[model samples]
Target chain A: EAGVAQSPRYKIIEKRQSVAFWCNPISGHATLYWYQQILGQGPKLLIQFQNNGVVDDSQLPKDRFSAERLKGVDSTLKIQPAKLEDSAVYLCASTLRSGRVYNEQFFGPGTRLTVL
Target chain B: AQSVTQLDSQVPVFEEAPVELRCNYSSSVSVYLFWYVQYPNQGLQLLLKYLSGSTLVESINGFEAEFNKSQTSFHLRKPSVHISDTAEYFCAVSTANAGGTSYGKLTFGQGTILTVHP
Candidate 1:
């Protein structure tokens, strides 16, 4: 089975510029997530989508970041007016619906965003 | 709120040597614990998980972790290491959301970089 897929494995942008990352989850997966991983730190959940609806986005920076999963299959995360602190890897993950057994998440090769 | 802590930033060990990576977590409710491995330029892969029942979980790759509820710790260990085992190990925890909209929103710890030299 194919795993989660992401685009533009690497990206570079200047401060104040805008950048966007894309993610296509595994087939039949019902849940999708976006995470940010800074150097030396674990990936932090930025937002979660259950189908096309948002499940959680408490940690997301609404002032600069936005994400959407219109069809609930692919997702896009955008950062406007990027700052130097936004330099980090953006990871996307997906999982099947929760059942009696716990669902395991599969991740994609993240997009390494370098904001100069 | 929930949080995970990886005690070590980096660990260097010779090939065939035993190694352990320590993790501890804090949470108010019941949680599911997991260990993920990320090779250079790759995505995170599940190493193992502890949801319930047995406190000890083992991965097919000779890696094992024991979940100690009393101590709130889950430490990954391997009897012998190989150069291929070098990667960043992350510890994470998740719990069922009260609203029932999601189940796997994970809170991760700062990762531990394990370098196995051959």
Candidate 2:
């Protein structure tokens, strides 16, 4: 089976510029997530969606970051006015379950965003 | 809330030698623990997981981890290392909320880089 897919494996942008990342989850997957991984650090959860509705986004920076999964199959994460601190790899993951279960998540290659 | 801690930032060991990577977590309620391996320019893949029952879990690639509820630790181990096993290993934890809303969100550690020398 095919795993999660992401676009623009690498990206570069100037500070204060806007950038967007795309994610297409595994087939039949019901849950999708977005994470940020800084160099030398593990990925941190940014937002989560169950189908077309958001499940959690408490850790996301509301002022600069936003994400949406309109049709529940694909999702997009956007960062406006990017800062140097936002330079990191953005990973997308998906799972088959929407409720409590021991489901494993499948991750994508990630989009490495470098803000100069 | 949950958090994970990886004691070692990097570990170097010769091939065919036994190795251990330490991990500790903090959470008030019960949690599901997992270990993920990330190769160069690749996404993280699940190595193993510990949910309930057995404290020990093994991955298909000869990696194993033991979950210790008393100490709140889950350490990954291998009887003998291989060069191909060199990668960044991450420990993560997630708790199921009382509302049965398991968003499957994970809290990951800083990660440990394992370098295997032939």
Candidate 3:
């Protein structure tokens, strides 16, 4: 079975510019997530979606980051006015369960964003 | 809210030697623990997890973790490590929200970099 897929494995942008990353989760998976991993740090969840609805996004920086899972199969995460601190890897994950429970999360290769 | 702490940021060990990576978590209620491995330039992958029952969990690669509820700790260990075992290991905790939904919002530790030299 194919795993989660993400676009633009690497990206580079200048400060104040905008960047977007795309994710296509595994087939039949109902839950999707976006996470940010800074250099030398672990991955942190930025948002989660169960199908077309959001499940949690409390940790996300609302002012600069946004994500959406329109059809619930694919999702996109965007950052506007990117800052040097925004340089990190954007990981996308998915799971089989769509319920209010937890399951094994499958991750993608991730998009490495470098903001200069 | 839950939080994870990896006691060591880096650990260097020789091949065929045993190594342990310590982890601790803070949470009021019961929680699920996980260990994820990230190789250079790769996304994170589930090494193992502990939900209930047996406190010990093992991965296919000879890695194992023991969940200690009272101590609020889950440490990963491996005997006779190999050079290929080098990677960043992340400890994570999952807890239900106010609405009691385990939405997969993992609280991860900073991470432990394990380097094995032959």
Off by over 4 Å in 3: A98-100, B97-101
Fnat for the candidates in order: 0.70, 0.79, 0.86
Candidate 2 error regions (>4 Å): B98-103
Q: Model 3 residue B80 lDDT?
A: 89
TM-score of chain A of 1: 0.97
In candidate 1 chain B, what residue range of length 10 has the lowest lDDT sum?
B95-104
TM-score, structure 2 vs. true? 0.96
Model 1: residues with Cα > 4 Å off, grouped in runs? A100-102, B97-102
Candidate 2 lDDT, tens digit per residue, A15-53? 999999999999999899999999989899999999999
TM-score of 3: 0.95
Count: clashes, candidate 1: 0
Cα DockQ of the candidate 3 complex = 0.73
Candidate 1 C-alpha lDDT tens digits along B1-118: 8889999999999999999999999854577889999998778999999887899999999999999988999999999999999999999988755443336788999999999998
Q: What lDDT does candidate 2 reach at residue B23?
A: 98
Whole-model Cα lDDT of every candidate shown, in order: 0.92, 0.92, 0.90
Question: Superposing every Cα of model 3 onto the true structure, what RMSD results?
Answer: 1.7
Candidate 1 has a DockQ of 0.62
lDDT of 1 by residue, A1-116 (tens): 99999998999999999999999999999899999999888999999998999989999999999999999899999999999999999999999865644488899999999999
